[model samples]
Target: MTDLCVEVERAPRAALVRLEGDLDKVSAPAFRKCLAGLAEEGCVEVVVDTAGLAFCDSSGLWVLVEHQRTLSGMGGTLQLTGVHGVLRRVLEVTGLRPLFASQL
Candidate 1:
């Protein structure tokens, strides 16, 4: 139950969010709120860096998918970087890897 830590860096129309620790049902709400704040600020492109992420549950995945859909609908994009371990496997197993604009 590692606490989630989020760090965001904003650009003109894009943002880079670095996520650390576990992303589960408990932390999804905070993550969702962070993304919603970016959207409200008119951010179009979002890059999520998960190098420090230790775990992710279904609730976390759902939040990501939801935000990806939202950004896509607005002609924006959501990309992921530093994917590995369980998160990588989950995305692959769920066939949801292609949903993001980029991955690494």
Candidate 2:
């Protein structure tokens, strides 16, 4: 797994988290940390840019889902951007695409 890097940028109405490297089990904790920070910041809208993600596992998916739940509980939302390859298939196979606002 590549060393995961997450960079957060603020937008006018949403916060964007740019993901770099693999988003699999080995690095999912870091992703969770980033997401938690955003939650703590009282973000009402979030965009997770996965354009540079090399890989992701079920654990990663769970973490993201949890983040979405967190946002939803707070009357917020989470958006997914630039998903591709296996990650895209995972979302389809698991029928989780409809749960998120995805950027094709």
Highest TM-score model number: 1
Assess each prediction's global lDDT (C-alpha) against the native. 0.94, 0.86
The stretch of ten residues in a row with the least summed lDDT in candidate 1 is 95-104
For model 1 the local lDDT of residue 43 reads 90
Provide the RMSD of all predictions against the true structure, rounded to 1 decimal.
0.6, 1.3
Identify the candidate with maximal lDDT.
Answer: 1
Count: clashes, candidate 1: 0
Q: What lDDT tens digits, residue by residue, belong to model 1 across residues 1-104?
A: 99999999999889999999999999999999999999889897999999999999999999999999999999999999999989999999999999997765
lDDT, candidate 2, at 30: 76
* Residue 17 Cα positional deviation in candidate 1, in Å, after optimal superposition: 0.2
Worst 10 residues of 2 by lDDT: 5-14
Candidate 2's residue-wise lDDT over 2-91, tens digit each? 888888898655799888888888888878988887788787699899898888889899998999888989989998999998889999
Give one clash count per candidate, in the order shown.
Answer: 0, 0
